[model samples]
Target chain A: MLDEIDRQLLQSYQRDFPLVHDPFGEIGRCLGIEEDEVITRYQRLKDDGYISRIGPLLNHTKVGVSTLAAISVPAAMIDSTAGMINSYEEVNHNYLREHHYNFWFVVAAKDNERVDAVIQEIERKSGTDALVLPMVKSFYIDLGFKLWQSTQAD
Target chain B: MVTDQDIIRIMQAGLPLCPEPYASIAASLELDEAELLRRIDAMLRQGTIRRIGLVPNHYRIGYRYNAMTVWALDEDRIDAVGELFGAQASVSHCYKRPSYPPGWPYNLFAMVHGRGLDEINDKIAALKKLIGDDCRQSDVLFSEKILKKTGIRLKNRSSEHA
Candidate 1:
């Protein structure tokens, strides 16, 4: 269960994390707590699956190139096919989203050539054509999500 | 010559929760602390680092439903309409991508997340109403399982440091 301070810690620091010598101490000062308390709460949150990370989100564009790709697979083959796709280090995310194209995943690599190579390799092995949809433009900088209102003692 | 890669490689595993986080990282990189901070700030200015902050697991935080809605919008109005869709509070990631015709006809992609079924449905309906008739066709994709994410196949076992 999250206390008021835990909720505040999660909600307030989604962006613009402190960049000082003692970041946890800095956060503690902001929330009227101590450095050790802030660190302990963040650690607890991670252990309990409340957060994934607490640091820099790099722009993938600056890092590499990537694409959104999908393949429609038979019900029986979904598991095997997903596993096969996941075997490649270039593939970053694989999700079984619904549709005729029921399996969607992303292929990210250091360059366009490598990204395309991975897609082709997947197609060759899977025997199903991939629907590649690369981004043309982005509309917003996702500053991070605002906390939804808690309904119960969670 | 402490490059961005050197700094990021150490920091990307998720900042160490210590009293002196950045200083510790800089020390590991064998570079001056001020130089590291300056480089990071410079990257932020150049849009290399989007944000330096917390990434919550929305599912754990009560946002149980995540719906990806795709709209087949006119080419000319995609810019204006995409902005409007992105500005919605529930929408997290929004992008304009090419649509393969005959079957797939969506150019604008937006994700809407909610706590439950009723709330998610209401949010989708509201988005359609917001877009009005410009939405020629639309579809929603609910993921059954996350086959793989980052480097972990999450039954929540692996140390997911994304």
Candidate 2:
């Protein structure tokens, strides 16, 4: 577990990783640590699954289009169905929601029609019907957690 | 450990191109290359920075379809249902959001994205079969516009305007 110093460092960086040339060096100066140490610790965190990904945050709407799609699958065949859906590279993330349509997942395709084609392919393969509800409006929330505020319990 | 100035410079300029970009950035700040490297490493270790890489552009690659799928689940079996739904690859952002009246029985929410409406429909059909008749209702909320797109800054910047 991270101590106070470690916690402070995490809180600082959780917002956004620097995009500078020598970000490590710059951050190190602030935190008073060696660049290699930061690199090593981050590597360890990622290896341990604490960090999900280290990549760009691209805009979805700007490119072409993207939608949030969902499907309901039988309990027995959920495993098989999910495996089939996951096979597509376009489908990046998936989830199992708690409801009658228990099995819901997302599919990022090249276009609206392409999204439909992939859904059709899933239907043909999984034999499950999906209700395609696209997003008309969306809300944004600052999901960032404040360690200082949250740490009051401790 | 990095100074606030370093972060400001990066956020202002955004991610740079070319190899050994950090070295160039260090030169501009009048900091040693070794020092810059060390600070970045420390910051990442401490969680001051999550990562240093390219964030993907989902729309550019042709993932146009997006929708919010809500499902009606039996209260007693929600745990089991959640496990099942969590296993799917298509569901990126999944959660149990609060429900409202007007016969809004569906309490489970999942995000589904694809190329178009048809692809999402097909998946929904398959999902219906897999989930059995346990779900009494389901609905999809399609996205119609692109509202806002940007990264979240960690610094405590004023947002009185927002």
Candidate 3:
């Protein structure tokens, strides 16, 4: 469980990590804690697997590409396929879902062509045909969530 | 350097869907568009602006079929295991989460989206062939509804929105 100060820290920093040279210093000033404490706690959170990363979330469209991919792995082979998929730097995330297309992941690249090429490589290597679904239009949403501060309203 | 006020303005205005959005933003700020572009380019290079793109309202967009997939594998093979799913294009996000309690079989998490259930099923089949027999249990956490989706403006002064 997180205390009020911890919650506040997450609310402030989760989605938008400050861009300054010394972000911990800026965050420390806000929390009235030492910069080193901020860094230590954050590192602790990551080490414990509470937060996956502490960095910028780039705009893929601006870079000219992004893809939302999914596959149906047999109840048996998920381990091997996940290992193969996550190894590629182009593949940022891989998830196993409840639906028939249980294996899903996202691939962001420099453009649509590159994104397609990466998908093809996966198909060739894994011998699985991955369905490519890129974002056509987004009405509203942000993927970032605050697990540390659950008391805050979503 | 960007101030809290600047962050507010950028988040509130949203990214312009124009050919030259940074230039358009600069026009409003009364700064040279070229200089503004240079700053934005630098910020991106430095990992300041994580992403500038559409926030998918999957429900509103009729993409009701979405799920969080999880896999449990021996610690030794995690990296090799995760890479298989990550390479696919359908997956939007993936990571290694802690294993579920005794009743659950999911250890690795990935977010996959589809137009409907049928399409999602077909994709899952192909994945099974790829991973082999050590998959353990794969569970799907379908999203029932969207709670909220808004970018965080790191330096903003107001907490009222929170």
lDDT of 1 at B72: 93
Question: Between which residue pairs do clashes occur in model 1?
Answer: none
Q: What is the TM-score of each candidate against the true structure?
A: 0.92, 0.50, 0.47
Residues A43-113 of candidate 2 have per-residue lDDT tens digits of 55454544433433333443334554557777788778767877765565565655555555555654789
- Cα-based lDDT at residue A67, candidate 2: 52
| lDDT, each prediction | 0.83, 0.56, 0.57
* CAPRI level of candidate 3: incorrect
Clashing pairs counted in every model: 0, 106, 59
A113: Cα error in model 2, Å: 1.1
- Candidate 2 lDDT over B48-126, as tens digits, reads 4445543333443245666777788776655555556656655555555444434456667766667667877876676
Report the alpha-carbon TM-score of model 1 versus the true structure: 0.92
Q: Which residue window of length 10 is worst by lDDT in model 1 chain A?
A: A145-154
lDDT of 1 by residue, B1-162 (tens): 767866766676788877888888889889888888888888888977878888888889888777888899989989988999888877888999999986888999998888888998998999989979888889999767878777311112132232
Evaluated at residue B160, the lDDT of candidate 2 is 21
Error of 3 at B131 (Å): 37
Q: Please, what are the lDDT tens digits per residue for candidate 1 over residues A1-154?
A: 9888989889888888988778899989988999999999999999999989877787888778889999888899987898899898778788898788988888887789989999998899889898899999888658678675552212
- Between candidates 2 and 3, the one scoring higher on lDDT is 3
Rate residue A55 of model 2 by lDDT: 35
Model 3, B20: alpha-carbon shift in Å?
A: 33
